[model samples]
Target: MGRRKSQRKNVAMLDSDEDNSSVSSSSTARSDLMSVSGAGDVQVDKDSLLEQALDALYEKRGSTREKALAAIIEAFNTNLRHQFVEKKFATLLHQCLNSIKKGSSKEIALGCHAIGLLALTVGSGDHAREILEESVAPISHALKSSSDSLKTVSLLECLAVVTFVSATETEETERSMQIMWQLLHPKLGSNVVAVKTPAVVVTAVVSTWAFLLTTMDGCSLNSKDWQESISYFSTLLDKDERSVRISAGEALAVIFETGIEKLAAENKTTPDGSILEGNKYRQGYTHILGLKSKILNQVRSLSAEAGGKGSTKKDLNSQRNLFKDVLEFLEDGYIPDISMKIGGNSLHMSTWSELIQLNFLKHFLGGGFVKHMQDNELLHDVFGFTPKRKNILGVEHQMTSGEKRMFQSPNSVLNKARTQFLNKQRMLSKDRNVGHFAFGMGDEDSR
Candidate 1:
């Protein structure tokens, strides 16, 4: 009787049809999984078995996350147990989030996996979307807090799942994308490699691009897409991380092929391609064209040499294989019916325009642009809205009266110009006052 009762506990996947999940149905072999609650020791204290598991999950001392993980995974493993978690999904999410933030490293790992699994299997219904909304909290925390590569990888894997599954039609999609990028951009530097390998970072990045695709409902391609992600990928061609560079090359090749095809189609068949002087899209195709031209030459040039000492053609071929596809695809003049599901990321089109106006094409795009950039801080006043740096800092050294403004320094060109203008005004005022003084009304004589 006890054995039969144990079999009836709620511990399984969100919806266990296995139709959409990458995990095989055969992988779940535990028929008496509820037996894991210690056969008879895990006496039910709550109305639901899953709640009982949660109670155990938050126990003050000596409680292992193994039980909590097993119970949650079991809930996600089969169709029957999914309802229990769904009913208490909010509680379930909170417990997992708490584990991620405050639990031991083992607990944190399980929490990461749990959130990932929820994202992977949670159906995209209204309630499911609500549950998914909770993902941003853990992801934000994990990205900032992960101290090691494996832990970072776990968090990134969760991100991959979240991005993949949440590509549904919704108002939240764009907001989520923005938030993800804001969090991701800061963590993409070489410093991330201190926490994780370059390949792991690349995989996380590729997963992010899955969200950048225009095919995702309610999302469309933007210029920033190229700047934020694709541009970075282009520069990675020369990175020490061979796998990262190779992956970046593949992405660039797809983008180049797709872009040229789109431009050609617009001009050839679309009756009115009068969008710009040199391109059909707008006056903005220059950067795309420039990027396309440079990347092709750069990748082709890479193939001409057996790079590194004693490297064979095989070595060279493997390294530049992505470019081989680009070369063949271009030579054949082939355009596919469907474009690759990827786009770029940037703060705004203005950021690109600013760079271009700075003669970005004639010179290298700049080492600063290649490295870390926060949209808010980097371009708060891209064209100088605030006082000059020297003006602000030089104020203290002068030791002037309190009346002078911080920006009113003698060193600044603008300040010098302002001072000349002010002196001229003061001289004119003195001349006018002299006339009034000499003309002598009764008050002037008294003075």
Candidate 2:
């Protein structure tokens, strides 16, 4: 009777173990079903009732993760209202960015694009700063991802967000500027997909820099930094990629405009109360002027080489287009300050004259293009008298003896004549119909 009782206890224990196993298996099945249902809810077909649900979520201004994603998609769609979409999307963007700290890679990338769309939209407001700060780690990680598309999208989105943030006048703008400056270095700017990225990012960066330098509020970038920016852009101009070249040209135009303004401002200011009182600033102005000349020369050399044989016509066209852009920039009242001051100095006169002559030649070659430099008075000052130098390929080649002598004295009559010549040439060039005698061939051959 003792052995039988022990066997019965053992059988009872086995039955209890089977019952517990059945309960555990049932619990696992319920858990799996719940997980599947949750996944199914999130994974709606692109063209099903799910789209309607997403639309409804966006319409209702839902702040849940699903709603935020739907709003982002709506912003990216081509058929949205500019103002309404931007405002609603910005609201969702803030919520999404706040969650990015704990989000997955896909989540972060989606957030980045949402911010990018906000940047593209007008009236993004102060939210750009918040997005930029929150995106730093995620963007950096995305940039390092093994997937090329992820890296490209991350770069473009980061560029847009930072650009919008830097445009504002708040103290937080500096953070965005710093991030942009770091990204613009050779390591990042020269990224493998630099060619394939959208032009908006490059354009935004250039515009932001221009605004910063021209305005008093933004941090002053050093000359070396500025030079590096130019160098990187210059390299981009030489890239085999067409879009990159076009974007580089646009950026260069902005830089040239700002540089011209800075140069003019420096030239006008004096240590004394009087504008006529020449001060130490002249040396600084002269150095800047030299730098400008160097940059222009480099551009000219690049343009020439890029336009040579074996190059595609499209490539040559781009180089010519860049040259035209530079000319247009210089024409926009840049040299007037110096021109007015040195009107009585022969060397100054000669220099202005040469610049005018080059402008005329370029205009003639660039399909009847006329720049702002070709105003009436500037034309007379440039071409009123005999050219000091003989015309070479429609450009004045050398200064004459009288011009050279005037260049020696600060207030010589020849200097005055030189200025008058420049003013006349400017006027003549202004009249697009006026034929450049220097460039015109004799009619004897036609007869």
Per-residue lDDT of candidate 2, residues 355-388 (tens digit):
3333322222121112111211222233343222
Error of 2 at 86 (Å): 9.3
User: TM-scores of all models?
Assistant: 0.52, 0.43
Error (Å) of candidate 2 at residue 89 is 5.1
TM-score of 1: 0.52
lDDT of all predictions, in order shown?
Answer: 0.43, 0.39
Off by over 4 Å in 2: 1-75, 81-91, 94-110, 119-153, 156-158, 165-167, 170-174, 184-245, 268-284, 301-316, 331-447
Error at 93, model 2, angstroms: 1.6
Q: Model 2, 81: alpha-carbon shift in Å?
A: 5.7
